[model samples]
Target: MDSRLALAAVVCAIVLCATPAALAQTVQVWTRGGRAYSLTCYTRFEVVPFYRPPNATSLVVAAASPATPPALQPTESGVSTIAAVLLVMSCIIVVVKSRSRAKFEMIIGKNSNRKENIEELLDNYGSLAPKRYKYSQLKDMTGSFSEKLGEGGYGTVYKGTLPDGNPVAVKFLHDLTSNGEEFVNEVISIRRTSHINVVTLVGFCLGASKRALIYEYMPNGSLDKFIYAENSKITLGWDKLYEIATGIARGLEYLHRGCNTRIIHFDIKPHNILLDHDFVPKIADFGLAKLCNPKESYLSMAGMRGTIGFIAPEVFSRRFGVVSTKSDVYSYGMMLLEMVGGRKNLKSSVENPSEMYFPDWIYRCLADLGSLHTFDMEYETEEIARKMAVIGLWCIQVSPNSRPTMSKVLDMFEKSADELEIPPKHCFYSAIQ
Candidate 1:
């Protein structure tokens, strides 16, 4: 025991005296019959500094190797899962934003193209262009289409007012087809005429789907109102009726010969004739008017036009005659006869079924001039009525060639009532009979 204590004392002194580098190095100090001791025994009093055995350095290194911490395994897996989820979310956000941007750009491009096309159209119209109004202006003028005046096949007519405080009529055409033929026809036909008898086109709108036409307001509206309204408050005298008749004749004559081109109005009727505040007749609704060179006397049509009762026989069947301005004369004649009798020409409810047709009965009365009183004869207006009947007979001749020109019709109006003779019964009269 004493020997061991002395040895430990010496070893302790050596350990305290040795440099740090020396202590860290492995040393071989074997004593005969000595037991092995570990370097970790430095903290215990029972252990003395001991020499390393063979291969002891490797053993120490192997034993000191650290074990992996269990806490880190779950943390690593959680971090990996969170990273994958973030990557997927980022991808989704990018795809959604890209799609939205593409759609927005496409819409903007379409709007730009449409605006450019409308601007180009307006520019092409140039000096000859009628007043062009914006969609907003039309809405303001029409008060959001509040007061409707009438509606027809083409569109609805609304009452409007201008900045100058002038009341106007606005016709808003329907967008029935991609080809706007009716709108074009109405604008072109009326644009060429500056006559007082024609309805004046004040302005027009061509904004998007809202195509509209502006015209001077006719306070008295269409002539059909007075002629067809049995309960009309204002009863027109014979003089006034005759004046309206002559005005319509002059309007037709103007269309036939007055302009540089012969404008044949395919549809002519009381509904199409508008009257101003002073009762001056103005021809309206020129959607079917054809503009032809003066030398062209006939027009070939692909289809029939004009109202059923007013359309000339030739218009429906080629066997009657070639279509011409005379077709309008036939329509005018029918309208004139209706105005004279204050009833429809083809009425089926006549007291005498034998005289159901107006023209047939009128012809029989004219054949015997003494029977004029049978026509509810007012002595003062009998001659005026007879004169109109003679003119009507001349206009409705079966052959288009037999029909007089509109100018001749005007001259016939000035002739004395007795001098006007009834037109002879032709194929047209026979067909009706």
Candidate 2:
């Protein structure tokens, strides 16, 4: 009976704590011992606690009273608002990410076909004749003819990435007015020879009206970028310059003697020389190359086939000498002199008469051996400069017969610089005067 009575009291207190009118009502209460109990009741929402005096032996329930809430409201509305905002942000992020991914996929899809075609060609050819590619495939390789590396009289070159992730340079031939002799010559000349110092023909494209050549991409690009410009992209040290000059000479020698037929590179200049990843020089651009019978000591050509500054005197007039491998030698010599001097061989708009012809100025400096200080060169560099000057003067002799052969040029490279004999100044000086 007593336990039931205590339980009833707790239930009443809970009701009073939850209801305002019930809490306001007061009720007299009795203990189990039949004693009147005085109790203090404290109520919080949905729960109540009672404090009893030491003399009290029973529980009491005060009438429930109306409860007033504190100023701070419930958190449900704020929580709902935050959840809604998060949902919208998440949806927006998903949409944005999807669009970005779709755009990237679309770009990849455009180039993928070209990559696949190039891979197929590489698989089939395996270093035979340069692989033939369709025009669409070339477009993909070159990214719609973008990223032009350079342009020449023949065509423009672009930088491209192969499907297999290898980089390549694509040379697109300009529309020709006459028969495509330049294209045919480049294909034939480069295809016939394979040497370390010679640029490799990676592939070619002859689809529809488009004609293009793909070559192994040279990372450092042409030698002229380093040689001609005062603020060159990459400044080559004297050692590197000498190494490039020697490599060019060796390449020319291989073209002359190593091939089945003697190949004369009618155009040899700094711009035609390309540098690979390690700065190894490779002779490139054989559009003007001529293949001759090994027995033929002289070749007769109808017209000149080289750059103006580097052209051999014989190529301009037969009065100088017969056009032969010696013509290439003469061109190589002019390029070598430019490499040594770090400037062009000829300048049309020069104010100083002595500086009008670079070869003459360099020849005068080398003859006296005292002008080395003017160049601000070190001991080793000074020696290399003198040797290159001596050999260059030898190769550019007015008479084609007076010029040393490519083989003799290589032999000279092997010897110490001190052992080289400076060629006597000839009609070249007189012509310039």
Candidate 3:
């Protein structure tokens, strides 16, 4: 229990203990709404110390009345019945008053006196756990921003600590730059939304150009570090990889179709994808997120957004028109290809020019299911290759109109393996396999 709360409790005990004479004089009658009332009644006894366990307070409090008349003298049986009725009424009054006081204590329940809300302890939510710092107190929380974490186009991030001594990640934006708007948007988006797959925004910091966003520190760091690591054979195994893929897709689906406002993740890539303690994927960094009416097809930006390699071909085309949410679908498709290939989609490595070409190879793989077996044979490779090839190929289709909606892509995932149709080999690599 908090020392202050304990002290308050002690005060409550003293005040209650000190007012015994008044308490006895006017028995407080209470209603369910916590209001108190008083009623006058005949009482031969009063309740004693009720707060103490094993020996509850009960003291005899009697009321005086006129002496019984000789004409009203009762028989032995009648007197016994009268006594029984009076005793029962006294017990009821004592029980009600005791329950009322206990109830008052309950309404005043505090987190200092008890545990955090049950939902906070549970997952499937992204909460800013017990905010222990006010703006002035944040300097100690971030260790004066001494611990450098990472830097991005938007701003630099740092590591921080809580009064409870738990460590957290904080991203600090340079207040003098345009990055402040992006940081504010990210905080607003995350605070309003929560899902198992969404990155939990722990809190935020605002000071001039020194704005910062706090997140639940992920121990493993970003997904790009693992996938793009040099000579590392530590593959995110089939099950975990599948979960990561599905979780990211679900997060995107929620943004694209589940949210009250349609969100287009203009920048969806391995670098923006983070992993949690359980290895579940969390979609992060929405600096490039564009909000638009779902009823519309395009949201014009200053220019095309997102990483160069992942951007949709149509988006980069000189003849192609404005960018749309499907642009993200195209980038996600490329990301899926990278996951399937276990190599960069557009490898700048001079040794193999063909390595940069992914969708074409995937198209060739789909034309010949035999090639599917060679991809991550340790996995249910044939099935994965087939599904990835289908979904990926569909997402990267030249015309955005041809690509399946996120809901349809999810439906395609749910359908049995046998039910999925292998898309026709129509790309330039179609004749190879």
Candidate 4:
């Protein structure tokens, strides 16, 4: 009995030890008839003795569990995860780069199209097309822009010499916001003109980002310098001033009538008039010029144009009249008044508030011819001033129809002061008032 009890204790200990490896290993037991049975050990174990006949033998065999596969280390697992993240990030970067490249190409395409359109127009100009120069050539011709002659709203002018040794004024435009419209206007307008009174456009330069215009250099510079020269050495005698005014009128007449296409100089002012060594006036700065068919009497405008004091009444308000070449006549009239007065038509610094409006003072001066003596002019000079003033007043009449054509203005200039009639006092007031 004691021997049987000890064997049962040994069997229980073996079963408990093999429980962890039960899934991978097999246990075998031999019974009294020599039949082998396989048993898998579990958490709960039971040992049962076989009934042996006479001298029967009992045997138990257990095989070890196969070695379990080695588990993955922490470092190796981290490496695989990192590699997947990098691949995903690379794909995202490539997609973003492709999109950005497409956007940049679109902007470049638009600018190229605009340039092509302008070039195509120039090609159609045939023999009328002005000379074209490279941007680099401009720098060479202007001596690297060494001498700046003047500056204005559109650009700066530098004195340059052409290959033929003829002097030229090179204007380098700085305002790009106009989308090249001003540059195109100056070129096209001058190309159509071939009058001594009109400034000659020698050449032009248009590139991706640079634009410039080359013109015949006027030694005497702009008319504003001489007209506004207060107590300065630059002074034009009354006779010379009359000649300059008449030359400007002829130039305007050419623009309005002589050209195949009627051209209106929207911004006609003293500053835009250039003078040669002989002080002969030449109309310039066609940035605000408009081209229309000669048969069409009126022009359509998108917005008001010209300097404030010189803009015609009809240009700012349709109630005054339809916009037409008459608008240019009005500006010319204002410029004439400024020329005779030696000051702006509207003066804020006048001692007498009544004289603040120059046209009114000059109009009153015409009624009493002796009042003109205040200008310290001789009889002949007063005659010239009165003729110019009467003509100017007639041109500035509030109604467009009331203003004479450029042709009529030239006629008035040729007439004697006594022969001319002063415009009605009611017609001289500006619409803005």
lDDT of residue 13 for candidate 2: 49
lDDT of 4 at 138: 92
Per-residue lDDT of candidate 4, residues 1-433 (tens digit)? 3443344455445444544234113232221111211122112111234456877766775543456344543233243333333333443344445556667788899778877777777788877888889989999999999999987655679999999999999987763545654466557767778798999888888777887888999999998888878942237888899999999999999999998678888878898899999999999866333321111112234466666688888787878899999999999999999899888888788899978888888888877653488777778888998899898998889889999999999999989998999888864655442
Clashing pairs in 3: 45-61, 46-61, 47-58, 47-59, 48-57, 48-58, 48-59, 49-57, 50-57, 175-209
Which residue pairs show backbone clashes in model 4? none
The lDDT for every candidate, in the order shown, is 0.71, 0.70, 0.60, 0.74
TM-score to native of every candidate shown = 0.66, 0.64, 0.59, 0.68
Off by over 4 Å in 1: 1-128, 175-189, 231-234, 288-302, 427-433
Writing each residue's lDDT as its tens digit, candidate 1 over 1-433 gives 3444454555555445765344333122221112223222211111233556877654422332246566544343344333333333443444445556667889899778766765555466666556778889988998998999996545679999999999999987763343344444446556667688888888777655777788899999999889876732138778888899999999889988897677778778888899999889999866433321111122234466666577788886889999999999998998898888777788877789857788777887888654468867677688888898889888988789998999999999999778887788764533432
Name the best candidate (by TM-score). Answer: 4
- Expressed as tens digits, the lDDT of each residue in 42-138 for candidate 2 is 2111112334578976767564444635334433333333333333344344445555666888879965765565456445545665767788988
What would you estimate as the lDDT of candidate 3? 0.60
Better-scoring candidate (TM-score), 2 or 4: 4
Q: What is the clash tally of candidate 4?
A: 0
Give a tens-digit lDDT track for model 3, residues 88-150. Answer: 445455446555766777866752233333323222234433232345556777778788877
Lowest lDDT block of 10, candidate 3: 29-38
Looking at model 4, report the run of 10 residues with the lowest lDDT sum. 36-45
